[model samples]
Target chain A: MKARVTVTLKNGVLDPQGKAIEGSLGSLGFEGVEGIRQGKVFDLELADRSEAQAKADIEAMCEQLLANTVIENYSIELL
Target chain B: MKARVTVTLKNGVLDPQGKAIEGSLGSLGFEGVEGIRQGKVFDLELADRSEAQAKADIEAMCEQLLANTVIENYSIELL
Candidate 1:
């Protein structure tokens, strides 16, 4: 089974890296880009686990190490 | 308007960060994690552009700055 986890910054949290990217985009002539936020994606391959079990396991992984709950939110997708 | 870009490493490319992450998951007792690959996501808010134009512009951004075409693949999402 394959799964994907997307971890994104929570609303209102300051994202300097995102700001930097936004600035760079403007400088590179991609005009009218108002805001940019950066996040992390994890693509995982598991060994014959059921989709439900895989989702549960990856959720636990996100809670423990993959995401900082205070500043980020994570979503899991089974593929 | 909003758009998202996901950038992932191309196959056959060595991924030390992904390996480290996988190792960390195992150490933290999340077993059965066979393989892990890491990627990046960019969330953007645009300034009142049409969805079609937004997609085109972000595509350019991805090709020119957000993604390294040589060893990475990028996908754009319109939202």
Candidate 2:
């Protein structure tokens, strides 16, 4: 089975990288880019498991290391 | 309006960060994590525009800056 974890900054958190990218985009002449926030994506290949089991495991993973819960939020998708 | 851009490495490309993350997960006692690949996500706030316009603009952004099409694939979502 395949799983994906998306980790993103919580609302109001400062994102310097996102700012940098936004600036770069503006300088590169890509207009209409009002604001940008950057995040991380983890694509995982897990041993075949039930959706419930996979989601449970991934949630644990996110709590342990995949995401900084204090500043970031994560969502899991199973495929 | 809002938009999202997801950039992921092409298959067969070496991803050291993903490898390190996978190793870390193993060391942390998270089992059944077969393979892990890391990618980037960009969330954007665009001036109110039609979905077609937003998608067209973002596609250009990806082509010129957001993604290295040679080794990465990008998908855009409008919200």
How large is the interface RMSD of each prediction? 0.7, 0.8
Which stretches of model 2 miss by more than 4 angstroms?
Answer: none
Q: What is the TM-score of chain A in candidate 1?
A: 0.96
**Deviation from native of the Cα of residue B14 in model 2, angstroms:** 0.6
For candidate 2, write residues A1-79 as lDDT tens digits: 9998999999999999999999998998877778999999999999888899999999999999999999999999997
Worst 10 residues of 2 chain A by lDDT: A25-34
lDDT of 1 by residue, A1-79 (tens): 8889999999999999999999999889888888999999999998887778888889889999999999999999988
* Chain B structural similarity as TM-score, candidate 2: 0.97
TM-score of model number 1:
0.96
Q: What is the interface root-mean-square deviation of candidate 1?
A: 0.7
Clashing pairs in 1: none
Write one digit per residue (lDDT tens) for candidate 1, span B5-74: 9999999989999999999999998888899999999998998877788778888898899999999999
Give stretches of model 1 more than 4 Å off.
none
Chain A vs native chain A, TM-score per candidate:
0.96, 0.97
Q: What's each prediction's TM-score?
A: 0.96, 0.96
Candidate with the greatest DockQ versus the true structure: 1
lDDT to native, each model? 0.92, 0.94
Candidate 2 residue pairs that clash: none
